[model samples]
Target: MKSTLKKLLPFAVVGVMSGATTVGALQYFNHDSNNTDQSYFTKASNVSFAGMNSAAVGDDFVKAAKTTVPAVVTIKNYQSRTSSRASEQDMLDFFFGDPFGGKGQQRQRQQQTPDNMPSGMGSGVIISPDGYIISNNHVVAGANKLEVVLSNKKSYIATLIGTDPNTDISLLKIEEKGLPYLNFANSDNIEVGQWVLAVGNPLGLNSTVTAGIVSAKGRGIGILGSQGKAANPIESFIQTDAAINPGNSGGALVNTNGDLIGINSAIQSTTGYYQGYGFAVPANLARKIVEDIKNFGIVQRGFLGVTSLDLSDDQLVAAYNKQKNTNIKAGSGIYVTGFGESSGAEDAGLKLGDVITKIDNIAITDFADLSMAVGSKRPGDKVQVTYSRNGKDATTTVTLRDQKGGTATRTKADLSVTEKIGAEFQSIDDKTKAYYGVNSGAVAKNVMEGSEMAKAGIVDGYIITEINGKPVNSQKDVENLLNKFSGTVQIKYLDDYGRGYQRGFKMP
Candidate 1:
């Protein structure tokens, strides 16, 4: 279990589960697709009658299940994990009193070694017959190799195309044609009470389908924030009660019509299993990410350049009210707290106290709504923003910008790995180990030409053995540890004589 799942949901699974963590490195399963044994499924919302017979909301979900199962896939991820990295549960325990919230009694669990390879499973949807698949980023985040198993038991090694951690969406490719796939549905038109099916391989069971309705839309569950990032993570989930489990990440969440509407992303649970709530990345946002990855090799996000928070939370709204000395209603609208230095808010006549109510024709009830609306567009895009100023409605046509406040289309080259990490490290060699008396470590191969590492006076051959307090045995270990870690870090290393040295490094 190298890179043991860094963030255990404490029953708060980010819609990604670990049902396949023990499936072994080279293990593969082929199962019969025709399982017709019916046994009172607890959740299926009724299928709607189109041109056929009349239907009710409690009708059988056979139609939606049958249509979606074929397009959903089980993905096996194989990645080298770090041996000494901490589990997400441990981190949560460090921050919160009870990892699974303050509910009931805390149960002790056995610990396992993390040096083993990561063998996790998740679900994905086939969007194109030519093998363009969409899934959550956490599903294939660190996978050195990815294997996608079709419902027909046919498996293909999937190629990683691009990933957006902020949105938890990734695009994958495989060489296949005329495969059973699900077309993207208009998620915006999906109502809150409409019937939907969650088709995926939960608990490693092939092609399981559960039924439920859209419980809520534009939900921000704080899962992405737990991973740590800058400028707030964009999340607008389609919440449902469709029984999402550990292995259901990246699965197809479809309407009664069997069209794809969302990708199951996280679950709101108590013990890391489904507990009447699950969340999905809306199809519109996922589709946009897929299109951007396919076209630009990077996600080109549009920015409104405004700092705002959702007024849906009672405490949040109360705080804003107290701070601003005004009575703002909760459960509706986004209260603009400030403007981004490079934002169009000021230029577009947006004030600090303005409350955003809508973007274009779409109603924005909270931050999730605003984020999803603006995030789906690209830099240089224009949108009509509607807001309230002292009970008076105001509208402005504003042009969005990138983080750099420019309208340039971003490519993969815009932010290279070197620019991200600041320094390049190499694995410790046998001779170096003998002289250094260290079991494993990474040698600073070369600091970036104008990187923070260079500014910090770090040089080549500086063997980095630890990041913060976690041991780093190799370059991959370093990368895995640094992925979601923001702010400042303590880099501990060994000199040529193996003498220890620690330095402060900031993640830029």
Candidate 2:
């Protein structure tokens, strides 16, 4: 009976093992057949695999960074100031109080006055192998002492060759020759999502590089100079998601090929630190400024003499509806709100409310395109501008003029207001006349406090037709005539209603 029971147990165990094997085989076959329906994924496990395939596809960025970084530089600046006596109220409080330090000690402290010491730090890009560097004007502006440090750890005292605060571009020169430098690329060709690298000295950290992509282009952040001030203030900027901090200003924004694409200038952040959005001066504009600095010692921006606003999608639609009878459509061009007298636009016969559609055959789809086209030229260069008026497309050849509405060369060291009459002015074109319902001459836009005009009771928007009894045809004419006068001068003009008036003042 024991032998029979043992044989039965062995058979029972074998039967159980066979049944488990059969079930496992059936499940494996069923899973494999289900996965076969999706060729891309042989198994459900394949769906969870994570990796990037594009990283293996590009060599452009690595090669570009190698070329661009050497041309980038670190900039340091120093300024000096003197402190003066405080107001009478403050002096009385110091002499009367000071229960914490005693009267004698307070008296001694008052005798030893304290003033602020100037200090600044920024970044720059070497544009020429002969030691020409470009940076933001604010970096070196009002700096009594300028110093430049190279990638090789070599430092040199830099000379302020020129600066244009309107465009916020400054040029510097070092005595050295044959330095490593970068060449500017066509910023108009930069595309969204393209890889870019920002190299600079951030937070005073020497030679730092951060990666990002072009988030946008042709951004106007409402930070431009006024008329008779720097003519080309508030330039269109290249916006990026690069991690730019305070000290990154004036750094290089280079493409993967190591070519200069833009100059990192400002960032949009609430905490005064990196918030993912950084602004850059397009290389196209920077190149123009650099060239002007090298040639004329100043940035001679071509003046259009028009106030413009970017058209939103809805506004474009409305414009298209208004121009339905013509080939022009809304959202397809820039609208001119006002025109300045003797401006390039005025000379070109461009009217207020005209929509600029193209320049030199290049389609102007937005303000960025227009800015890029205009920024590419000097003050005297002529270009064809196309616009739509009353549904008809027309072309006009406009000779670009300086901010003064005349053909004049500029230098980097030239301050628009300080170099001239220390005041701002705008032309009184037909459009301006129509807007104000009357105009006879150019109007004063702004008078700097303590300037020659300010001391003379000259108010902003005051019309001026003559200076020192000489006909002032344009702002340039005013500037030229004022330069001829040293102490006192006479200004003549008509008010908004064409009423003649005259005034006399002393010049600094």
Candidate 3:
């Protein structure tokens, strides 16, 4: 009886062990990381995973995307691109020899083949409900016609209102109402590493949204003056890495709340594609330009009227110190080299030797910083200027003046054009004339589309010194002379490179 009991006990113990193993296997198989679902080990074990670091929850940009995507748009620019140019023919003659021989030459001069249609595309941000859109100047600069398409697939013909090349911003209107627009955010409040979204028609893909963080602030890429678009340009770009491509120009870069912080302008890449770096014009400055264009028909720029030298420029520092008996070098902020005629600097009692330390409360770290601060000001605005004279800090209030050195606003409207001259002009300013060593000339500001200037291969930044071998001083002089003169008219002009050239255009 004792032997039989022992055998039964061994079998019972084995059965109990088998049952425990099966339960453990089931628990391991159904293991879940959710707090609600836990195994015996997870509940009973004293082990902790708290020492392991976990990422903080990030913002879900869904709401921002929904709010912004509707306001962003695609801008299509259509230009009547005449492929047949005299220079192209000349280049053909030089490289491959004229295909039509000398026969094509006479016809090419007398008649232009205006069939090939050239077009460009970019993005834009609708700022107002009544159809005011902000975009990069290069996007719609020479477009004969502009077409705007919304995210909802609605299309409208956009009118070219005005452009400010200095800031690389252009204002357009679509004559439509009830448009969803994005409000401007305080760009100064945007911090690096803050979440940002770029919404636009990148690569012609409509309503594309990309997310990133603000990589930098107050970045100057120097695309303005060098491009022959503007003389004194201001570029304090908010740099980001939200994958801005070819068609992303003029798109909206918004904060997490979907507020427009900037208008995407340019990309810094050698391959012409997004290699991480993207730039945008600050919303504050852009808004100012839009209001100026809407009210004044042109940007009312405030001129400090001084040829200031950036201390960050090593060559400029060397030249200045050598030319003038003084110890000047980098990190001196901005030093006044000379004064303009009744300029803001002169009015504020700023001297040539003064080193600008700050503007208002913002520090002037460099020229780009100074440009950003002053570039946002209007002609009549008063700003508190801070400087250092002989290493002593000083402050003064300056009444900003226009480029013409006065408070009176300069209007570009109502200037009637006779015939299709295809360009706008102004008598070269004294500063510009002295720089180019030219006595009298009219500087071509806007070279219009399908005009005689465009046909004659004249471009912006060309200084027209003489017409038919006679000096033309102002816009009136140009119109008066062109009105009276007939047949082939020879225009002597100085290119931005200071090289002189002659171009002939026939007018009946």
Quantify all predictions' global Cα lDDT against the true fold: 0.72, 0.68, 0.75
- Residue 478 lDDT in candidate 1: 74
* TM-score for predicted model 3 compared with the true structure: 0.71
RMSD of each: 15.1, 18.7, 16.5
Put down candidate 2 lDDT per residue, 1-508, tens digits, no spaces: 9986775675467546634743563454433332110111111111121121122213665676677778888887765432333222233332343344455344544644232322667889999888999998767754657788898889898988766666677899999888989989999899988888888876655676766788888886545452233445656889887667666788899988888999888776543445457789999888887877788765566767787655645665566557654333446678887777677887779997788888899987777677767866777888899998888999999888876777666652345433555576666677765654333457776564334564344567666766765655467777677654577787665544444444456654
TM-scores, each model vs. reference: 0.67, 0.63, 0.71
- Candidate no. 2 TM-score: 0.63
- Ranking according to lDDT, highest score first: 3, 1, 2
Once fitted onto the true fold, the runs of candidate 2 whose alpha carbons sit more than 4 angstroms away are: 1-62, 84-118, 225-231, 307-309, 313-332, 408-508
- Highest lDDT among the candidates is held by which one? 3
Q: Write the per-residue lDDT of candidate 1 for residues 29-101, one digit (tens) a residue.
A: 2142111111101222332211211124333467777788988998877754322222333334432434466
**What C-alpha lDDT, on a 0 to 100 scale, does residue 311 get in candidate 3?**
91
Least well predicted 10-residue stretch by lDDT in candidate 3: 35-44
